[model samples]
Each structure stands twice: as structure tokens, then as C-alpha cells.
Target: MVVKTLNGAKAVAEAVKNCQPDVVACYPITPSTHIAEEMNHYYANGDTKTFIAVESEFSAISALIGGAATGARTFTATSSQGLLLMHEALFNAAGMRLPIVMVVANRAVSAPLSIWNDEQDSMSQRDTGWIQLYCKNNQEAVDSVIQAFEIAETTLLPVMVCIDGHYLTHAVGQVNIPPQSEVQDVLPPFKPKIFLDPENPLSLGVYTNPSHYQEFREDLHNDLLQSKEKIIEIGKKFGKRFLRTYGLFEEYKLKDAEFVLVGLGSVMDNVKATVNELRNENQKVGALHLRCFRPFPSEELKKILSGKTIGVIERDLSLGAQPPLYTEIVEALQGTNTIVSSFFGGLGGRNLDRTAIKVLFQKIKSKKPLKEWIAQQKGDQK
Candidate 1:
């Protein structure tokens, strides 16, 4: 293990290098650009070959698709509009069961055009048939990248390791870059069972008429749901080898709590801090930090949140409907007495501080289902 101070992007790049990807195709975008730059640096220094600098984000993912179709371990990174641009290829990669890993530096999508940290981008692709893993900090970002490859390869599904844009990507912190040998032990070379070879040629993403298209989608959906077990298994294996265990979601002091907060990504750090302070005051408040978003752990969440007052804070909205995370939680706890509420904050990189979290705790304690915005007031404490 090498202890080094690295920003999230560099840490992720280091992890990717250690994983020994066969090909990397990327288009640089804000917050995620540094990741692409770092990978390019590795390629320039002869540490890696087959780095493709593409014309656009679409081209970047297209290149990865081609590489993966040939049984190559592939990777890429993108953010905001760059990610949105790859929407078409995203489905292609997942539907074709390509085990490609990507790092999504989560940023807000445009109309107003912002380059800051938020979960809007990744959340928008929730149904794209890819596994989504959110990181809480830089070290977790590094560990998640290492685990993602194993999970993807084992399940034959693409995985997106999402980090809060500038919050993690640009923020420097101490990250342990596991030795290459250790990583290789956990994630051996990806030798896929199928590929585009002339000797054993077969169709991949061919035209499936209505008769077979629905069946293909159903199989992909069922496989994605079943992949959750592989996710948990790989996470445990990584933990045993590296001494850093992870799961579908992390429970922060939720065992005996009556009021709980739920969320994902970097904001959970603030959520945990506020929970600590409130606990000191004798408030039975806890936090649930969701690590895996896609495959939506509904049953696991229902078991944990069966009889508690829950407040869900999210950085993205579903427009005319309820917030995405809150909606999922509501559906998960549907017939229960869980009393889930929704709070939206940090949209387009707005700050979500401890003060806002405290306000949310107060609201959830009321036991009345509600929807509100956090930290929007000018008078709110920073």
C-alpha cells in the first residue's frame, strides 16, 4: 500500500492504472478532465498503451464499446454534458453485457450550464442498465474503482463509479493506492467468454425485432438484479484483502435511532457530522448513505427503515414528480409506517451544510410526510 496525497481524479487514475486496463477511451470534461489527463500521462510515459483521445464523448464511449467487444478490459471518464452525450452508447454497453468500467465525476446537467458538483448527471441515467456506485470520499473513490472492475467482470454488466464532481474530484486527500499485485489478485485479467472475433464471429447488439427485443431487455434486467449479489461478494472480498469493506449501502449509527436521514454521494459526510452533533444532544437521529443506486436495494432499505421517520436529502429532482431518491425510498417503504419525507438541496452545486441537515432532522421529527428544500434561505447558516 502506498500512502499518497491525491485528489479524487488522480486517485481514480492510479486505481485504473493498477487494474491494468487493456484500453482507455475518454473525452475530457470539467471535474473529470483531470482523470483523463492523468490516464493520458500514464500512456505518454509508456506505462499504458491503447489510450484513445476521441473527438467527442459519444466517440469516446463508442471506442470503448469497440474495444470491449474484442474482449479488452476497458475504461473511460466523463461528466455533465459529456455523460449525457454518451447516453446512447451507455445503453449499448449495458444491453450487450460489456464489462466496461467508467468513472462519472457527477455534475449537474445543463440548460443553465454549471460546472460544479451534483448528482444530477448520474441520477439521470438511472435506468440505463448499468451498475451505479457512489463514493463518499477520495479513498472510497479509489477503492470503489478497484472493486468496480471485479463486479462488472463477474456480472457482465457495465459499472459507473460516481464521485461528486469538484467535491471529490478536485479536493485533495490521503489515499492509499493498493499494490498492483494485490489488485491483480482481487481483479484478475478480464478474459470474457464472448467477443467480436472473425474466427468465432457472432452478433452483438444486432437488430432484435419486437419479438425478441423485450426478452433481451428482460434478461438484462434480471441479470442486473442478480448482480447485486456479486456486488456484495466482491465488496467483501476487497474488504478482506485490503482491510476496507464496502456494501450496497452504509449505515451510520442507525441501529437504535428513531429518526434517520437518507442520501448518497459526498453530502453524506455532512449528514454524518450533523448526526453526531444531534446525537450528543440526545436526538435519536441516524444516517443511511446509499452506495449502490442502480438495482435500487428496495428490500434491504425496507428492512432497515421499517419503523423510523426518514428524511431523504437529494441533489437532483425528477421535475414534475417527487425527487428521485425520495420516490424510490417511498416505494420501498410503501405499506410501512416509515413516514419518509423528501428534501431537495445542493442543486447545481449549491451548498448543503450541517445547518441544513439540522433543519431536516427537525422536519423529520414532526412525523408528518413533507417535501421541502434545504439551505435555500439566505439566512441559513453556512
Candidate 2:
């Protein structure tokens, strides 16, 4: 399906169909409703094997975990409070190493109760042991979901395909859906190496005394530590099969850039456009977007920012401090003269346009400034 106007939700649904998941579950929520609705459509048409409609996001994921445990290729999606509702289950899915793939339409948390796009929703699950992958556009949104499943299954860990809410979730854009035959050829059916079975069933999430708990936890951590390279390798293979290339870190005009902007999610297109226009006028500016965050490409970031000044446009703010993503960027580029600065923008679906990116360039050219307020996370999730 070569779609020209599908938003992130439809694009993700299309990709799921192309990836041919065995089970998909989700609950309705703003920005994420469409993804579920579309997948439900596919299920209605008999293209999808299982379409699970549940009472809440919590139940939706619970169904997914059950299906995955039964050796079914399972998938689920959520955003904002829906994500928070499923938080405990997120821990269960990861700890049990179910290799479940989820699509998180990144959205802002509520206090005044709003349906808006922000990174906090997924970022809140940073410590849940799920592999977090951010996308720069609809194409990446679709591509990452397919790639996410591959990585998750290989590592026996859950993965979150995080896309900018509203930015990609609502915006109509051109997306390249792979040919059915190619998708099938590239992605083989998911066969669980270990699962719940009648013949031989093993206890999952069992109580391990200090004697074995730490060892399992360490193995999980080490598996994730090893996923950085495996993800890159799987991404390369996925890209080659689909005729797409993902370098894990995408760089634009960073060759001789003095001031560069590093961003994640769908705003990357706007940043790329602004960079091109400004560079034409002799501005030493560029942009580097992080596609994978959890297994952060630290070495690649260090190499790219070596001796170059870079600014991080943080859409997700950190309470009582600079943006959370900004903090990570500074840490990654530390020990180098790279003057990494932080510029926070895009909250509640605010417009982060080319003009805003241009303005950010001016600020970077001058001394870096901090003018954004951090909204405190107030839910029990904190």
C-alpha cells in the first residue's frame, strides 16, 4: 500500500498488516484510537488473525501478554494515560521476556486532563526494561514497528515503537508500505523459542530468592546491553530487504557544522528543511536525530558531536530541570568541546515548525539559552 495521506496511526496499522502480526490488542485513546481502529479493520477483513478489543489499555496488554505467552506473535498500542494504566503490565511483559511489540503514540501526561503529544508518556516507562525506539517520521514509524518486532523476538524483550504524537500521529504524509511478497520474504513468522505449553509449562515471573533473582536480572540487563549491536544489525538486514537504509543515527550537514540540532521523532523533517535553507545561506548548522534511545548509540553520538557544538530540541520536559532528552544528550556528548545546548519546544501539540527551528538556529549561533518550564509529573506513575 503506497499511501499518500495516512497519518502515523494508519501508517502503523499498515505496517502491522505488512509485518503480519498474529495478535493485536489495544484500547481507545486520543491520537492512538486510529491505530487500533485500522488494525481492527484489517481483522474484520480477515487479513489479521486476531483483533482483541478489551475494556481498557491494561486489559488490552494483558490479552497480548497471554497471547504472546501462548506462542503467538502479539502486538499492542497505547498513549498518554493508557500507557500509565498498563505500566505494571509493561513490567510483567518485560520481566517475563515475552518479546511483545508495542506502538506508543507518545503523548503528554494529564493533570488538567488533555490529549496532547509529548514524549513523557513513553519516557515515563524508561526504566521498565522495554527497548525504546523513537521514529523521525511516518516512514520510520512504519519501518520501526516491523523492525521492533524482529529485535524484540531475537532478544526476548519487549520493545516500544515510540512516535511523536500529533506530529506523526495526526499529520498526513507519504509512507512507503512494502510489497506483500517482500514483507513476507523479509519477515518470517515469529516462532516462540520458549512459551507456555501443555506438554511442558514452566513458571513465569516466579519468585527467585536472592540466589537466582539477581542472576536473571543481570542476564536481562546483559541481553539488553547486547541488543544495541543486534538491533543495528537487524535494522540493516530489514533495510536491505526493504531497500531502506537506517544508520541508527541520521546526520545532516554535520560534517563541518559548528552548531547542530539533535532531535527525535517526526519534527526531524521540519528540522531537516530548515537546516537545508539556512545552510544554503552559509550557516554551519545541521541536525542529528536519534532513532533508537534506550540502547542509545553512545559511540555514534560521541563520534558525531566530537568537537562540534550541538543543540537538542527537547519536546519532553523534565521537572525541576532541563528537558529529559536534553540531559541525555549532554551526557552523551560530554568529555568533548561539543557545546551541546537545550531548547525545549512542542507541548500539547504545539506548532514546532520550520520558523521555530530557524529561531532555534539563531539562539544556537548566539549563546544557548533556557526559557522553558518543566511541568511536574503528578500521577502515581512517578
Candidate 3:
């Protein structure tokens, strides 16, 4: 393993090369474009066999679907609107159980049209039947991409590795890129269970009537839920091999804390720093980072947040109702005494500083509903 200072996209590209995917489908978009760019460099050097540059995000994922269906390991990366553009193909890939791994440099979807960081793009497709794994930093982003292929190939389901755009994607950080020889032991060659073979032809994605349609959906849902076990198992194996631990969610100084903040992506760095400061001030505060967002980690989350005052910090909202992740937390802690609250910030890549996090904790302590904006604009609202 060699430790190198690299941006999140570059680190991920390195990991992808080490894993040696059979096919790479790339479409350019901000922040996420670097991942494809670096991978193209690998292709230029003859490190990768199949590198496809498609016209659009939709075409990119369509190519991935074909690659995966042909019994080849496939990968792609996109951000915000580009990801949304692949929405239709995303479901098709997951529904067909392609195990295509993708990286989403999480950015905001637009009506006002700003190409900035937010969770809205991926969160909007939370129910698309893809395994969503979020990273807090460049190192985690690289590791997540490596593990994603393992998890996706294991379960025969697609995986989406999400990293905060611009914040982590562009920021240079020290990352340990595992050697191809070492990574080979961790992630073996992809041997697909089924594929489009001419010799033994088989029909895939056949139309089903109302009678079998519901059953098919049920099986997909159940399979996804059961995949949680494999997720945990793979994480443990990775840790044993690499000395780096990962899980569905990571708890930070939560033991005996009365109030805790829950969030994902790069914002957790600020939350952790703020938690340490609050702890020094004799405050019982903690933070939880949701690494695995798709499975929701309900039982585990409920076990930890049973009686604490929970503050959910989200980069995306459901609009006119609860925020995306906050709603999931509320459902998870349904029968518990957890007083759940919401805190939204960092929209359109707005800076969410330590002051904002501290103020969020303060509001949680005072039992005051946190409805104030944490960005450049200050306001009071109900």
C-alpha cells in the first residue's frame, strides 16, 4: 500500500483501477468528471481493457447495464442532474440485478440551476433499489468504492458510492491506495452467476402479469433487506485485511451523551469537531455518521438512539414535509423516547461552519425547535 496525497475523485479512480473492473462507462459532470478523467488516463496506459465514453448520463448507465448483463464487472460515476438523467436506467440496472457499481459525487438537483454539492440527487432516488454508501472523506471514499464492488458482486445488486461534491471531491487529502496485488486478495475476479450467453440462451426481464409482479417486487425488497448481513460481513473482512473498520453507521462519542447529532458525508467532520468542543464545555453531546444509507440500519440506529434527543442534519429535504434522512430516523425510532428534530444546511454547497453546528446543539438543549437558517442568510421561522 502506498500513501499518496490525492483528491477524492483521483483516489476512487485509483481504487477502481486496482479492482480491475471489466468495463468502465463514463459521462462527464462537475466534480465527478475527474473520476472518469483519471480512469481514462489508466485506459490510455493500457491498465484497463474496456473504457467507454458515452454521450450522456443516460447512455453511460445504459452501457453499464449492457456490460454487466454480458457478465462483465462495470462501473460509472456522475453527479446531481447527470445522476438524475440516469434515473430510468438506474432502476432497470437494479431490477435486473446487474451489480453495476457507481459513484455519485452528491450534488444538488436544480430548478434555479446551480452545480453545487448536496445530497438531493442521490437521496431523491433512495428507493431505486440500489445500495447507497456515503463517505465522509477522501480516504473513506476510496475504500467505499473498493468495498462497493465486493458488496454489489456478492449480492448481485447494484451499488452507489456517494461522496460530497467539491467539498471532498476536489479537496486534496492523504489517502492510502491499496496495491493491486493486495486488493486482488480482498476482491477476487468477477464471476457472474448468469449472463447473456448465445450458446445457452435465456430470456431476462420477461413481462409478468399482475399475479407474479407483486411477488417479484417482494423478492427484490426482501433480498435488499437480507443484504444487510453481507454488507456487515464484507466490512469486517475488509477491516481484518486492511486495518480499517467500516460499518452501516459510525458512532462518535455517543456513550452516555444526552443529545446527539446525526448526519452523513463531509459535514460529519464539522460535527465531530463541534462535538469535541462541546464535550470540553461539560456538554453531553455526540454524533453519528450514516455510512450506509440504503438499508437505513433501523435496528442498529434504534438501539443506539432509544432515549436521546436526536438532531438530524440533512442536505436534502422532502419539501412540505420532513427531510429525507430525518424521516427515516423518525420511523426507526418510532416506539422509543427519542425527541427527533431537523437541521438543514449546506444546500448548493453553502458552508456549514462549526458555529452553525454549535447553534444546532444549543437549540437541541433548549428544546427550541430549530427553524433558523444556518447559511449566509439569517432568519427566524416556524
Candidate 4:
């Protein structure tokens, strides 16, 4: 099929169409509302399966959880607050191992109640045990959804395809919509290992005390605990068929560089361009863009920066202390043979452009993570 520019919301609905998903349960919210709108339109016109609009984001996920429990493939979409509303049931879905797919449009959580792109919202929920995949562009946003189903179903863990709020969800970009035939050939129809039945009924959601809770969690633990390998495998399969690069991490000219910078989401592009300009001046520097957040790849990260002094830029804050990814990188390299510091910059759409990126790249290796996380970090630390 020919690749084309599509709005992120339209691309999301398009993926659902290609998957021929059995049910779409959703409600309206900024950045995510369009996805539900498009799917509702298609379903009303008989393009795909039944689309149901729930009263709230919570209800939407609740409905999806119900459908998936009944052996139907299901999906939903939401922004920051909407995702928050579904927080309670979120654990239940994964605990039940329903394999639901969700599109998370990144947004700042409110107190001042602003609507803007930020990684804080999703980062806050990282411990919820979802297999989170972050996308830097609209195409990656769409493609991740399709790949999400494969990954989620295989491990029986719900997957979150996270897109930066305005950066991705509102941006227009070229994306090759997988044709119906290819999708059919690839995504096998959903066949649940366990499902709610009437005649063949069995107990589900059975109460478990501390003794069984560990093992119940052990199952959920194993699903995501074993996820790094399966996630890489799914990304490879998606890449082979789609020509889109998906991996534990993506590097730009890191092999010969003495200094490498790292970041995630759309900012990685800016860092890459800055690296290119710096390389022209004989500055040996590169970038490592994180495509996956959950099941952090310690080994791959170490192999890339085993002996090099690298720097990491976080677009979001970690609250109280530390850039989120920075802490993880420090842990990953603690006993290993590598040196990486952290720089925090560009929170809540601060726009860390080429100049800012170049400056960070130039000085990242010299400063510690807390001192350079953002120009703001030093004061906070003091």
C-alpha cells in the first residue's frame, strides 16, 4: 500500500481498521477524542466492528476490559486525566492478562489545568506494569498501535502506545497504512486462552490473599518480566514488513563518538540534527533515542555506552529529585563499565532546539545529572 500523510488520530483509527478489531470502547478527550470520533464514524458506516462510546474514560476502559474478558479483541484511547480516571481498572486489566491496547496521548496533568505536551503524565504511571512504547512521530504513533496488539496478546499484557500531546497527536505526517490483506495475513484473529463463558463457565477475578497474591502477581510479573525479548522480537517483525526502525534503542553515529547524548520522543530529532552539525566541526558526538520505556534494556544500553561518556536529556521532570531516565541509566551503569551523566531540559514544551541541544551535547559529559538536568535543576537541588 502507498504511504501517505495522516493525522495521528486518523492514523490510530486506520490501524484499528486494519486490525479488524472486534470492539472499540472509548470516550472523548483532547488529542484522543479524534481517535474515537474516527472509529465511531467508520463503525457507523460499517467499515469495521462495533464501536461503543462509554460515559467516561473509566467506563470506556471498563467496557474494553469486559469485551476482552469475553474473548473479543478490544482497544481504547485517552489523554492524561482520562487515563487517570481509568487508573483503578488499569491494573485489573493487566492482572487479568487481557491484552488490551491503549493509545496514550501525552499531556500535562492539571493543577493549573493546562493542556500541553509533557512526559510527566505517562512517566508517573510507568510503575503500573504496562508495556509502554513511546513514539516520536505520527507514523511511529500509528505503527506502534498495530505492533502493540501483537506484543500485548503474545504476553497477555496491556500495551500503551504513547504519543506526545501536540507534537504527535496534532501533527500531520506520512504513514503507510497497512492494507487490509496484509493485516489479515499478519494479525491472526483473537482466540483467548481463557474467557467468560455461560455453559463452560469458570471462576475469574477470584479473591486471593497474600499467599496467592504473590503468585498471581508472579504470573503478571513473568509476563512483563519476560517482555524485553518479546518486545524486541515484535518490533523486528513490524520493521521487516513495514521498513520502520523499531528496537530497544536507536542510535545516531555513536560508534566513533567520545560523547553521546540521549533523549526520547520528538526531542530526539532535534538532538540528532544538532549532533550532525557538531560532527561537521570534528566534535565526535551522537544520540541514543529510547523507543521503549518499560522493561528498560540494561544490556543493550551498556553495550552502546560501555566505555563512552554519554549524556541524557529528559523532557520531563521526576519530581522531588532526578530526571526519570537519568536515574535508570545510572542504575544500568552502576557496576558496569560505562559513564553517562544526565541533563534535564525542556519541560512542558520549553523547546530545546538545535542551539540548546548543541550546548547540552557540548557540556553534557562534564556535569553531573543533578547539576545539568535542566538549567532549573541546580537551583532546585540547592
| Model 4 pairs in collision | 343-373, 344-373, 344-374
lDDT of 4 at 37: 89
TM-score of each predicted structure versus truth: 0.97, 0.93, 0.96, 0.93
For candidate 1, the TM-score is 0.97
* TM-score of model 2 vs. true structure: 0.93
User: Worst lDDT window (10 residues) for model 4?
Assistant: 373-382
- Tell me the TM-score of model 4: 0.93
As for TM-score, the candidate ahead, 1 or 2, is 1
lDDT of 3 by residue, 280-320 (tens): 99999999999999877899899998999988998887777
- Residue pairs with backbone overlap in model 1: none
lDDT of 1 at 84: 92
Ten-residue region with minimum lDDT total, candidate 1 = 373-382
Off by over 4 Å in 4: 367-370, 373-382
Give one digit per residue, the lDDT tens place, for model 1 in 1-382. Answer: 8999978889999899999899999886553559999999999998876799888999989999999999999999999999999999899999999999999999888879888888889999999999999998998999999999989888999999999988889898899999788798788778888999999979999997888899999999999988889889988998999899999999999999999999999999999999999999998999999999988999999999999999998999888888899999999998988798889978877888888788889988889999987757565444
Question: CA lDDT, every prediction?
Answer: 0.90, 0.81, 0.87, 0.79
lDDT of 4 by residue, 75-94 (tens): 88888788888898888888
Candidate 2 residue pairs in clash (backbone atoms < 3 Å):
none
Q: What lDDT is reached at residue 73 by model 2?
A: 86
Q: Cα RMSD (Å) per model?
A: 1.4, 4.3, 2.4, 3.3
- Model 2 accuracy (lDDT, Cα): 0.81
Candidate 2 lDDT for residue 295: 68
